[model samples]
Target chain A: MTELEIIRLYRSGQQEKAFNLIVENYSERLYWHVRRFVCSHEDTDDLLQEIFVKVWKHLPSFRGDSRLYTWLYRIATNETLNFLHKEKIRASLKFERLSVEMEEKIDDDPYFNGDELQKELLKAIQRLPEKQRIVFTMRYFEDLSYEDLSEILDTSVGALKASYHFAAKKIRTELKKSSIQL
Target chain B: MGKDILDDLKRNPYSVPDGYFDRLKGRLNEIAVSSVDTVPRSLWQRIRPYAALAACFAASFLIGNAILRKTAPGASSSDQFYKELMYSDLIPVTQPYAIFEMEDEEEMETSDEDIINFLIETGVSVELIAYVELLED
Candidate 1:
């Protein structure tokens, strides 16, 4: 179903049908977007489901002010930021707990393949400030226009361009230092 | 610099490992079955500001009512008026008191009794009081 029809179905209380339609429509696209930011398949799985849950809850308030995809993108961006922030706070609050969680993931997480280069790239992305990472991911991976990034980030187009430039430069340098070719 | 970097990054494609989407879909279906009724945090965030604003308005109205009871005219004006009335009789006499001819004895007697009681309570003697009793013709 088209996004508009799915939205209509959801509003009319056909939640299951609407949800299935949304999954069929955007699951691949959202997975790739989320996977770019969080390399671990386990983390991306959690984030992807969380993103859809967010979309379902917020669909009623969608005024069609922007395209449906833009709205979804905005939610995905915010959820990723919040996830990172919470992870950072958790790490600060209890370093041991953070390490334990990492160890548990490393030991038993079925979704994590432990690809060295992809893991390094994600670690470098995480090292970036939130705005730079967002700009970088949206620009490089999602191939979003600067205008769309500006709308999603609530930043001026010029600033987003600058942020993306700096992020790319940093990522390239980091990759070179690690002796990994892009 | 921005254009150059953007173009280069565009040339580099970031790919998810195989089956990521399928796994994500499976996870979503699991969540839907497990907790189908729960709303997301982002939706609640959008409405939170309005809830806060309503709470502020309710608090302001209650506080205004409390202030009104303490300072509005009905609460303080009557007490102020009674105090002013009590002090009005203390003003000094500057001129001769106005007198009119009396016409009845019974009313005069009541008035005289009232004056005697006033004097006894206030420590004024009958000699210090001025009498204006009406004589019956």
Candidate 2:
């Protein structure tokens, strides 16, 4: 169903149908958005469920102030950051350092099927500061407009552009140093 | 070099575990049910610290009772029962959980890199952040 149809269904008291449409419409996009930030398939799976749950809970109050997908992305992004925040805390508390944890997870991840360059590229992206990493993924990979990103991030357009520019520069340094070509 | 990096990075090198997207809706629906039970979750969160304190008190009480019983004159059958209760309650489950939490609390540290990098500009003022938070609640 279209976004409009989902909205209509929701406003008309068919909440389940409306929510299912939301899941159908944005689940994959939100999953990828989450996956890039978290960098672990298992973590992404768990976070995706949490994201959708938040979406379901908040859909009733969704006033169409912005696009539906944008709102969903905001929720997805916030939840991903929150999840990563807790994970960083958890890792430190247990003496399982994050850098070490990421190394082990990358090695053990069943879904990391990329070749060496691709793997290196992901590692480079991983090394980007968390917010820059997010900006890089959404801008460079997802091709979202700065206007849209600013809406979701609640940041100025110029700041986002600067972020992506610096992110690309950092990523380029990593790729060039590793001799990983496009 | 810049263009080359963008081109490579945009190649979409990631993949989810098999059947991940296919099963996503089902999984989401299941979680949504639990999240909707907001009352229970908030109640539990509010009471969690109290619950932990209560558990500690119970543990200490049992230990103290056992120590007194050990020192007192003719040990009754009830002494054996109380000793058994303390051993059963403290050793296998409660003690380990408390120890784990204690260790976790002690080691709660944050990485410097994480603090340095969380620099996304949220253009809202502190008051707006507080206001939005209020509206959210």
Candidate 3:
């Protein structure tokens, strides 16, 4: 269904149809986006569900100001930032808290095969500043245009291009150092 | 120069764990059922600001009415004064006898020409004329 139809269904209280449309339209795309930011499958799973829940709650406020995908990406970006911020705060309060959760989630995640190269790439991504990482993931992995990235990140096209460039450079260097191809 | 890196990143699409979306759909359904009570929580959220605004408007109306009621009597009296001034020309001389008596005495004492000449020669102010009339009364 078109975004308008989906919105109409949602506003008409047919939330099931609306959510089904969301799943059909964006599940895989959003999964990849979430996966890029988070390391393990369990974390991505948790974050993905939370992102959709947030989307469901806030969809009424969307107002069609931007494209549906851009709006969704903006939500994803915010959730990821919040997740990172909370993790940082928790770590500061007790350093072991983040590590323990990370270890448990990583160990328990069935989808995580823990390939050395993927691990290295994730570690490199974790080191990036949030904006660069988001830009890079959107541009490289999600294949979003500069315009869409700008809307999602609320950054200028030039700045987003620069961020992506720097992110790629960092990732390439990290991959090389770890002797991981591509 | 670094197009190759970007290309590689693009080519190697990230794989999600199998059945992630299906599981997510189930989890969402679970949340939806469990969150029926939480749904009303948002109803309160939506109503909160409007309720506050309604209270403010009601308070303002009451305060305005109170202030108006407090000052209404004074305002009405001032309005009466202005109304009297507007219709002053229509005010009837209630005691015509007194006015006729005053006019006759003044006419006997002085001719109109004498009064005019006195006014011209002395350059008597209107206030003096009013005072003389008052003294005669």
Candidate 4:
């Protein structure tokens, strides 16, 4: 089913049908979207499930002002940021660096099949400030348009562009510092 | 940094367990049922914070009143006492009690009756005042 049909089915009280269509259509997309931010497949799976649960609960309140997919994207983004923030706090309470934990998760993940260069790129991405990292993920990995990002991030297109530029620069600088060529 | 690399980055490098999407809808069905089961529990969770705030408000109200009522008997609260209250970490709030300070003592006096009247005017029940009075007596 198309996205609109799913919303229609949901609004008409065919919640189970609507939700199944949603998962079938968008689950993999969202799983990949979440996975870029959190490198571990296990954590990505956990977050993807949480995102769908939130979508189920809050889908009724969706105002249809923007594309339905963009709304879903916004929810995924918010949940990912919140999850990272909580992890930061938890790690800090234990005197741990969140980036160090992330790098370790990347290393320990059996699901990862990328080469060393890809891993280095991921480490560079993780070292970024949270907002910059998110902007970069949405732009670089998801290939979302700046207008779509503005709608989801509630920021202006110019600001999103600047954030992306800074994120790319920082990642490139970090890569060079670590003797990893792009 | 090239367009080709950016395109490559857009391709997802992550994978999930086999049959993950096939099983998700069923898991969500269980979630829907479980969410329904936890409705009453969630309602309590929603109510918990306001309930705690009410408890804190009531405790502070009683404690503040008690402290005011027993300010070293016959030591007539000085201007410094209320000043300390204003500057102290505790009770930075503006209240009827602040008006009853020693600066106004000569004009109005900080007697138990004045405190009772103040507390009553500020919404403390007269019954509570009489109960505290009985305790004092």
Sort the candidates on lDDT, descending order.
Answer: 4, 2, 3, 1
lDDT of 1 by residue, A85-109 (tens): 6876887787544434543444443
Better candidate by TM-score, 2 or 3: 2
Worst 10 residues of 4 chain A by lDDT: A173-182
Question: CAPRI band of model 3?
Answer: incorrect
Residues B1-103 of candidate 4: C-alpha lDDT, one tens digit per residue: 4543333444555566778767765675565556656646677798999999999999999999888787753454676665665556564356647534534
Per-candidate local distance difference test: 0.68, 0.77, 0.71, 0.80
Model 3, range A11-104, lDDT digits (tens) per residue?
7998766776777788667777777666566667788889888887787687887888788888987897788779868777875555445445
User: TM-score for all predictions?
Assistant: 0.54, 0.65, 0.58, 0.67
Name the best candidate (by lDDT).
Answer: 4
Segments in model 2 whose C-alpha atoms lie over 4 Å from true places: A94-97, A180-182, B1-3, B31-137
Worst 10 residues of 4 chain B by lDDT: B1-10
DockQ of model 1, rounded to 2 decimals: 0.09
Looking only at chain B, model 4 earns a TM-score of 0.36
Model 3 per-residue lDDT tens digits across residues B15-132: 4656767877777655545654464557878899999999999999999999997655445557666455445544457854543453436456767568857885888887888788
Candidate 2 chain B minimal-lDDT segment of 10 residues: B113-122
For A1-182, candidate 4 gives per-residue lDDT tens digits of 78888888888988767777777777778878888888888787788878989988997898778888999898998999899999999999999999999998888888777767677778888889888988998888878999999999999999889999998988767766665344
Best of the candidates, TM-score? 4
- What are the candidates' individual DockQ scores? 0.09, 0.34, 0.12, 0.22
